[model samples]
Target: MKIKVNQESCIGCGACAAIAEDLFELNDDGLSQAKVAEVPEEKKEQATEAMEGCPTGAIVSE
Candidate 1:
């Protein structure tokens, strides 16, 4: 799976990082960013939760 964050839409709520710290984080710009280019099978579920939990819909998965 692949995941990405729309920086423009991200509100830096930390939900993604809280949900999947291994896969997401807040950058210096204070927006959520995907830490990995590809989502590992083991982390997919958590990534999904992060995506769903993002209030700004900044997270995207494929």
Candidate 2:
């Protein structure tokens, strides 16, 4: 699986980072975006949760 974030739709809610710090983070832009590191399979659950928890529906999975 792969993860991606839609910058325009992000609201800096931090739900993704809250759920999976290893996979996501709030960038200087103040929006929730994927970290530089690759997302692991173990984090899929929290990642998905983050995607769902996002108020703006910014996160996506492929």
Show where candidate 1 strays beyond 4 Å: none
Q: Each prediction's Cα lDDT score?
A: 0.92, 0.82
* Location of the lowest summed lDDT over 10 successive residues in candidate 1: 53-62
- In model 2, the runs with Cα more than 4 Å from the true position are 36-38
Candidate 1 residue 27 Cα shift, in angstroms, is 0.4
Please tell me which predicted candidate would have the highest TM-score against the true structure.
1
Clashing pairs in 2: none
lDDT of 2 by residue, 1-62 (tens): 77889999997878789888888888899987787345687887888888788898888887
Number of clashing pairs per prediction, in order: 0, 0
Please, what is the TM-score per model?
0.96, 0.86
Q: Tell me the RMSD of model 1 versus the true structure.
A: 0.6
What residue pairs clash in candidate 1, if any at all? none
Residue 12 local lDDT, model 2 = 85
* Candidate 1: tens digits of C-alpha lDDT, residues 17-59: 9989999989999988999989989998898899889999989
